[model samples]
Target: MIITNITSQKDPERVNIFIDNEFAFGLFYSTKEELGLKKGLEIDEETIDKIKVRDELQSAKSKAYHYLSFRQRTQKELEDYLFKKEFSEDTIENVIQSLSQAGYIEDLDFARIYVRDKTTFKKFGPYRIKNELLQKGVSKELIDLALEEEYHEEIQELVDLVKTKYSSIIQDKSEKRFRRIGGYLQRKGHSFETIRKVLDSIDGKDD
Candidate 1:
């Protein structure tokens, strides 16, 4: 843990620190005066260890931020991901906290966005979308709120999907087309009553 080299760059206000022939970390300060970068200083083993810990924490935080940039992830999902990358538990927790503070890893926000996207774009029913969110480790409370708030949109979207899939066949006079379409909607995760109602609306059938 020897401070091998320290290089400063003017354009970006950054200092690159090297230890034992390995690049340890970079420090960014508003001005050269911030870090007191005077000469004749000896960095001992304890200081080097502290710097290494800080470097590792920054590295882990960068990794977590990049992963979140690609897509939203549940808390458990992120924990598993960081664990797989061999980050220490303290580092993982600190990185996760930083992301949450930056409005990145919000489970409730994720659940709401998931439901909205599923209802609007995927045209999935509440049951299917809710189950998917639950599988992603979303809590039941947010799932319930998502379903309750988006029920009408969810139902309409499912109905639209069923209609688009079976419009021509449902118009036929054959009962086979009706039953097949009903079963299709049911298998798509719509409730029985909802399927029946949507099917009947398209076919002008009683009950």
Candidate 2:
């Protein structure tokens, strides 16, 4: 087929490629330039298929990079994002492999950083952080390793959190007050045992 036209899309970086007076496909302007595609240039069907594959892979990588620019993402998250964007499995796998090799898609690093941020900034407990990582598609082994390496539950910090945030309930010194305090901590990702320890410390029951 002979190339008939190359019209720029609304996106300046992209262009619509027409072959034999029929709209063939859209491709990156760079790809068009690199391949020396122009009006009346003769191309074959096999060449068109190859160009489409290359263009799709490039497009998938671009989308993945943009999505990751906002924050670190797990492989599964990127896979889901690319799937939603209608990229083929082969393209998705290629993009993922490329990103992984380039050190842009490290689930273990993402998990470690996530754990540190949640524990330090959000004061989230291990359980809640674990659930959040799981939801983000991090592996169980990586999550456990990250939690072990990064999660240092400062008893004093928990004490301060309870004393400052739940002082009213603490002052009540009733079973109901204990239950409420425990519930709040539990929701914050603390285990029942840790909550009990904190309550005991608060109630002068800690030895």
Candidate 3:
């Protein structure tokens, strides 16, 4: 087929190529120039396939980079994003592999950082952080490792949280008040054991 026309897309970096007077494909302007695609250039089906594959991979990588620019993403998050954009499985896999190799898709590191930030800033307990990491497609093992490394001071965190946020309930000094405090901490992802320890410490102070 002979290249019949080339038109610039609304995106200045992209262009549409027409072959035999029919819209053939859209490609990056740089790619078009690199391949020397222009009117009157003869192309074959094999060449078209090669161009499409190369362009698809490049487009997928570009989109992934843009998506990741805002924040770190889990592998599953990136995969879903690319899939939603209608990239083929092969293209998505290729992008994922490249990102992984470049250290942009480290689930373990992501989990560690997430756990640290949530625990330190959000006051989230291990259980809640674990659930969030699981939702983000982190493995249970990695979650456990991150929790172990970053969540070592859960008891102290719980103590501070209760003292700061539930002081009024503690002053009640009733069984009902303890239950209420326990419920609140549980919702914040603390375990029953940790909740009991905090309550015991408060009870001891009263004695």
Candidate 4:
């Protein structure tokens, strides 16, 4: 096809390119320059294919940056978002590598920040935080390391949280109460063993 025209977009950073007098695509000015695209230039099918790939990569990366502008996201979250937006695998992978190398996407850093927020602010327990990070595409090793470094602090926080729940007014150690407290801890992502241990100290009741 023959290039018919190239026009500046309102954003100034992008341009609309028409081939054979028909609008084909919009590309960043940088892409336009790199591709040496200009009016009246002749492009074969193979060259058009290359341009499509470049456009896809640029579009996908731009979307990724826009998504991350709000806050950080996990690799899996980014991938899923791009996939839903209909970006191809090659484009998604390219964006991922670019963002990761740029330090915009770091699993370990994300895990640490996420864990701290959930624990300190939201009061989420180990099980819940670990599960969340896993779902967010953090490796098990990194999760273990992040939690292990603050093992004592986390356990102490868990104990304090349980105390806050079990005030002195509720003295009855009934099966129902045990179940209720256990369920609460479990829902918080605390293990049964830890729940039982805490219950033993606080309620001194049989379950």
Name the top lDDT candidate: 2
User: Mind giving the per-residue lDDT tens digits that candidate 4 earns over 1-207?
Assistant: 899999999998899989999998888898989989999999888988898899889889888999999998989999999999999998999999999999999888888888787777766778898998898888999999887764333554665676777665246678776787788878978788887777766655534
- Stretches of candidate 3 above 4 Å error? 154-156, 205-207
Descending-TM-score candidate ranking? 2, 3, 4, 1
TM-score of each: 0.74, 0.93, 0.90, 0.84
Q: Among these predicted structures, which one has the highest TM-score? A: 2
> Could you tally the backbone clashes for each prediction?
0, 0, 0, 0
Q: Write the residue-wise lDDT of candidate 1 on 1-207 in tens digits.
A: 455677875736567777676776676433223434333445677765665567667667767878888899988788888899998999999988888888888888788888777766766677888888888888889889877776554444565676677776756758787688767765555777887677666656634
What is the full ranking by lDDT, best candidate first? Answer: 2, 3, 4, 1
Q: lDDT per model, in order? A: 0.71, 0.92, 0.89, 0.82
**Preferred candidate (TM-score higher): 1 or 4:** 4
> Clash pairs of candidate 2?
none
- Provide the lDDT at 151 for model 2: 96
What number of backbone clashes does candidate 3 have, counting pairs of residues 3 or more apart or in separate chains? 0
lDDT of 3 by residue, 8-91 (tens): 999998999999999999999888888888999999999999999889988999899999999999999999999999999999
**Worst window of 10 by summed lDDT in candidate 4:** 150-159
- Clashing residue pairs in candidate 3 (N, C-alpha, C atoms within 3 angstroms): none
